[model samples]
Target chain A: MAETTAATKTVKFIISRQDTPESKPYTEEFEIPYRPNMNVISGLMEIQRNPLKADGTKTSPVCWDSNCLEEVCGACSMVINGKPRQACSALVDKLEQPIRLEPMRTFPVVRDLVINRERMFGALKKVKAWIPIDGTYDLGPGPRMAETKRQWAYELSKCMTCGVCLESCPNVNDRNSFIGPAAISQVRLFNAHPTGEMNKEERLEALMTDGGIEGCGNSQNCVRSCPKGIPLTTSIAAMNKDTTKHLFKKWLGM
Target chain B: MKGNSYFARKLHSLLGIIPLGGFIVVHGLANYQAFERGPEGFAKGVGLINGLPLLPLLEVVMIYLPLLFHGIYGLYVAYQSNSNTGRFKYGRNWAFTAQRITGVITFVFVFWHVYQTRLQVYMGKITHEELGSTMHHIASSPVFFALYVIGVLAAVFHFSNGLWAFLISWGITIGPKAQRVSSYICMGVFVIVSALFILSLVAFRGDEFNEVASAAIALLGNIG
Candidate 1:
């Protein structure tokens, strides 16, 4: 029987790197020791430890953003193998070798795999994607929601603001001011809430503004690209109806 | 730049489905009459449309104005968006890009078509009876034939895919199942309409219409 050596088992990565946000991006290759069930994040961590290029030259460690190693936290979202997905959950064994790691270009690159997600956050704020609750002192028992409504609401609530949906969207480029599907879905999520209903009209009105719901090109990419499988396009369609109704109401002085 | 108002976007989608889309379907079916009844049937259909009372008003309101708004606003919307099919190569993303690209090609082609056919008629350079022969004159050339072929395909795609997008945008087809069904239906519409339009083009291919075209040109020369 032939003996299998661990030294021969290695994973290759072609990482796009930028030393600074203002600097140009370039690719660097690295070969890391392969481990069973390893992920892109694990490979990145290995690169961080060794800081060696594939050609045996010493180099700076690759930069990326991550918090929870699991997929819940959206910080580690990047283009892995040309798909915008969570780096934490991308298994090396499942991925074809020479794994490509690049920052999601929809946003401005902070450096390497880390991108500035301020545009997404700005969109979230524009839509007021939260239930406004004032007074810190013991506000007991907010309004209850029906079980079915809560079930779907929980699904919408799973959006980690990871910017994957935006990254995959065509309308969310530098020239366009479209708020994107993620923020629009958040509007639907908050609008469905019992307490969030208080600001429902406000949210709808905000969506009627520039870069709001009108920005959606109905590309339907957000729903497909969402790692959490959030029904983003459904929310957009619903909001399209709501915003139209709101516009009619505003015209009628209702 | 600030985007269109919510009402404007709604109107854009609405106008596309209504007067414009309705006009394409009607015009396509009218042209399909040529396949069964030859060029004379197509001429009669054109004459019928021309014979309507206050025809210019109807043309401006139902066709020209709505087309202008939809086309110009569509151009604006297309300009404001970017295509990311290179990164996210989903079916819907590709359809999105196709919709925009076809919109542009259709816009240019529609303008040329109107100028060649309708404007000439309005200017009294050609009569309604000469419509089939004029179309034959245009289509007999390899270059114009290629242009019409591409233009017709683009128009068919734009209208069909725009129908699907309209259903989703208006919240008519919210779920994946409904969207899938509507997509297949729209594809059927595209194939049928495109076949009919191409058939009409082919109907005008022979030299039989050239005699009528020669007479029309002779009349124009005398008037000039």
Candidate 2:
């Protein structure tokens, strides 16, 4: 059945390809065997198996980053159908013809469909989006968070470091380091955690930096684009309030 | 830069909106006059503005100084920001590009407006059929009109978008409900202001007040 399917019909894809970090990008067309219930990832896998372009030219297999086949990882995000989204969950049948695939330009394309998401991680670092636990010594089960707070913080912790939000954010481009919405949201998440609050001042201090929280242009695009439905702009507003209070506190040396 | 104070940064963003946002409100109101009175009425409206005591001085103090300060500070802030393109922690926030692009366009538009209206009028370079007629002529010209339309639309979107962020930055808004309400108000104000300006231009072109203003200007010239 698989062989018959391979011989019967083809699904076309025009993928943007880059050979190296510095090299100019070009498109390569591929026709893969169509099958029922084929997702974008499965189609890409078929191409990997063939490693042949539509012109019948043998080429290296296309390179892309993916961890979970589910949309949870956000590693396989790219522009599909003129919209930035995750490839893992993008169904092939729902996509229009030409099936245009391009790397998200918000990040430096490390290779075809692979981008350097280091900036996002760096922003996370800058904001200290984690609990600063020093040792492996069994610290008695960490201080408990309020149930209500934990519920919301859990929503924020759903962020998979996916660059989808960043890819869709206009402020995350090469021109400005506005820290974007994802980091701000993460700040809210970590700062709300019981132990994470230990570094609350540091996180607040990070947000008060030049490329920090003040950089948000508040386009609200992040809220719309987030696959996780993370309340980014809300976090930004919360942090805005917290930072203002923090500023006053600093002024009073509280 | 840690602990160096982000107050300047915050102030920079806040002060930057005044020139562009405030100008839109004033310009929109000025445009509304064109709808009813025609080009001549529009001109009269502008003339009335000039008649006010210290009008030029006020423009210099309020408009020019704010424009310069905002533009310069915005540029400095833009330069200081970190350019890290990646999947942001949240999602599609294009605040920086929108602000910068709109700022440039607004800057250019304001300069041209002053050049044609204030400089030319003051220097006796070219007289309008009436102030309204000149406005109509400018708006009727495809190039000037196109630029004006684009500039104004951009200005409106930029202002509304910035207003959302500004409210958030200052802690005026707290939750989803607040944001929704504020967003509607911002968008509503932007639409009303922009419509008023467009209507004024359209009315001026329809010759609503041009004939009267032209006749008046001609009669005054003959009498003098």
Candidate 3:
């Protein structure tokens, strides 16, 4: 009954905008013709085609990042309606007006809706969230993982380095340097790999360092906010246990 | 101080549950004697503890030292935590913030409570028998009694909620469902323990203790 309401013919948007990396952010309102199945990205594209303010004034086109136009890439992440989520999957029909869009400030904001997720990348580097391989030496096929192990490993592998978990976490703010949950889960992912297990101790060691798993305040927000539904809290707990073991092992000189 | 911090954090969490949390539960049970029997029973419980061999050493090792570390390190951790609940309003988000807030409140309340009671005992200001009467004096005051109620509530809450967080960080509760159940269990623990301590506080306000305490107080010449 509400679908065909004349009031629903147009979608309203209040997008937070920053002209440059160092610029003060401001919110601008826009109105776009509503379509039956239009997602937030499609609404932004409509604004891009004809950039105009709701007051009928000419303005620059609102800029945002999106690829795969699906929820998978996570590059399209932004705070929509006060939550860190992918705009590509936030359908206009499902959102309340005026739809509020802001950049996730867990990392530095680049421009409009894009944030520089360099901290997440830096965390991934710190934890060594990768398997080592020498392509030039023509190594044989890597050790096979059991189907059972692979099933769970695939869940963690789905993490697209989205900053949603970090954005949702209060402990991951500027004052504390908590590595956040995404990278922690990635550590679990890489360590579970047969080849990646060779450096399990090293990964666990990295996790024990400053800004590691210990920095987690156990707010448990990361698990709920993850669009990929990666078991972020479980990884954090698993890693917490591993680091405790590694600490004792070092203490006993094992 | 700026090293891995893994051991330091783990040690803080462990110390909180160990000597500190254990001390709270035991203290609650001991105080319950006031409600169970009267001033005589409460005095006897304290006497039993004091009569233990190496009592001072046990107090130092099991209570003071661990509390010092947990309280001090917790303050440092609290200073570093910047909770933005206004932006991200979630249940656990508030709980994360509440844990830090209750920690500070509990520490302050505990410090004042100790300074008022234990430090006085050490300074020969209050004798062993007069301890119950001292509680009677404090709990008889509406202000002190209210503050005591708040202090006990904060202490019990911090301990019980800290238990929940400890289970997660230590990997005992691995999933959402497990964490949810643990929260309920911890709250259940909080309610039971808080009732015991509060009942003790209320019992202390009763005048039955002062007559027995006065006889003992008569022996301590020129005592406050």
Candidate 4:
């Protein structure tokens, strides 16, 4: 009788499903046997295994993405009960039921819970978010960074391009071309490097254009929603100052 | 498309604080004379401003142009924001949304205010000395009185919140702690400055202000 009671306990999920890239999205409820410590991804895996609605109707297996079930990969990001976050880190016990999952509408949904992050990657490319280093041959020992500078820079280096910041940001959406906070912070990271400083003006120039740094409305959602706890607002403020100085320098013919 | 809003956007921020925001501070303090010294004192403050050399040029260059750009560009900025604060519900997020909402309210209030006062004076409907009496008449109606209260509160909020954003955007307050502290300071500005405007509104509605102000206006007209 005790074993049956354990078996009967279940967790319910309401998943927003889009059958194809162009399909009309719908919500489907599923009940899975409750486990001691199941994350949203593990519950999703259970749904994939059974592919049955809570009403006992047969359905197609839910399609999603997950790699490195830890939070670092950022591949398992979705709207877990209205807040966009990494599903792998959103534990069943901690979340309010019935747990709801939806694809981040900031990006286009490719299939159920799977969004195309092309725009996010496109934004990174627009801002030159990485150092342009060729690793074909060995170079001399890199320019030394101050220990104090590296201490804070290390915090910013944790960004995994998870798209969480973009989803949470009010400035980044379909209507506008805001490069979003992630890419801007990455620009700050790369520019602080001794060699990366060479391209500093070019990067700042990129931010001075359309869909660039000017788009930020200071809603500051990116900092609060960042799973990596990166100081996104700090970077934005720094870049804002940098961009303003750059504009003045241009006017002065500097 | 690579758009360069860099300069225009920066100008909007700069103008908000410099001449436009500066004007709000002066305007609030000037109106406070109504509360502090009754009708006679309020007219004296208005006279001092009008007596300034190059007053028309100063008003046009420092106040009107900057106000036009900031108000119109602000409307565009507000419309561009597509995010809702309901889900996030963070303090900064709510402040962000409230800033945009108050901006629109303030614009309407400012236009209506200018039309009723400055425009009327320009049209010779009232003299500088009669300004106190005009305000009393306007403030006498319950409907207009309520509108003035909401409008004053909203405009004050917009100025205080915009000051906070101006500090961050210009890189003065970079850390979370610094930003948090400035938020408090700006709120202090909002409360104190709001009191000045509200007190002036109450003074405008009082019987003493109307009677004394009308007599003063008549005496001034005879001397002129």
The most accurate candidate by TM-score is 4
lDDT of 3 by residue, B1-224 (tens): 67667778888999999878889999999999999989889999999988999988998999999999999999988987878787767778888888899899999999999988888999988876678998998998999999999889888988998999898778788777888899999999999999999999999988797776777767565564
**TM-score of model number 1:** 0.94
RMSD of each: 2.2, 5.5, 2.3, 2.1
Per-model DockQ against the true two-chain complex: 0.68, 0.33, 0.68, 0.72
- Displacement of residue B198 (Cα, Å) in model 4 is 0.6
Q: Is candidate 1 or candidate 2 better by DockQ?
A: 1
* lDDT values for all models: 0.89, 0.77, 0.89, 0.89
Which residue pairs overlap in candidate 1's backbone?
none
Per-residue lDDT of model 3, residues A1-254, tens digit only:
67667756889999999999999999999988877899999999999999999998999999899998878888899999988899999989899899999999878999999889888899999999999996778888889999999999999999998799999887777777789899989989999999999999999989887888988998777887899888898889888777777888899999
lDDT of 3: 0.89
Model 2 misplaced regions, further than 4 Å? A1-7, A135-142, A251-254, B1-9, B16-61, B72-102, B116-161, B174-176, B195-224
- Place model 2 in a CAPRI quality band: acceptable
TM-scores, each model vs. reference: 0.94, 0.75, 0.95, 0.95
Q: What global local distance difference test value does model 4 have?
A: 0.89
Preferred candidate (TM-score higher): 2 or 3: 3
lDDT of 1 by residue, B1-224 (tens): 34456667788899998989999998898888777688678878887888899999999999999999999988988887898888778888999999999999999999999999999989988777888898898889999998999999999999999999898777788778888999999999999999989998887776766776787779888998
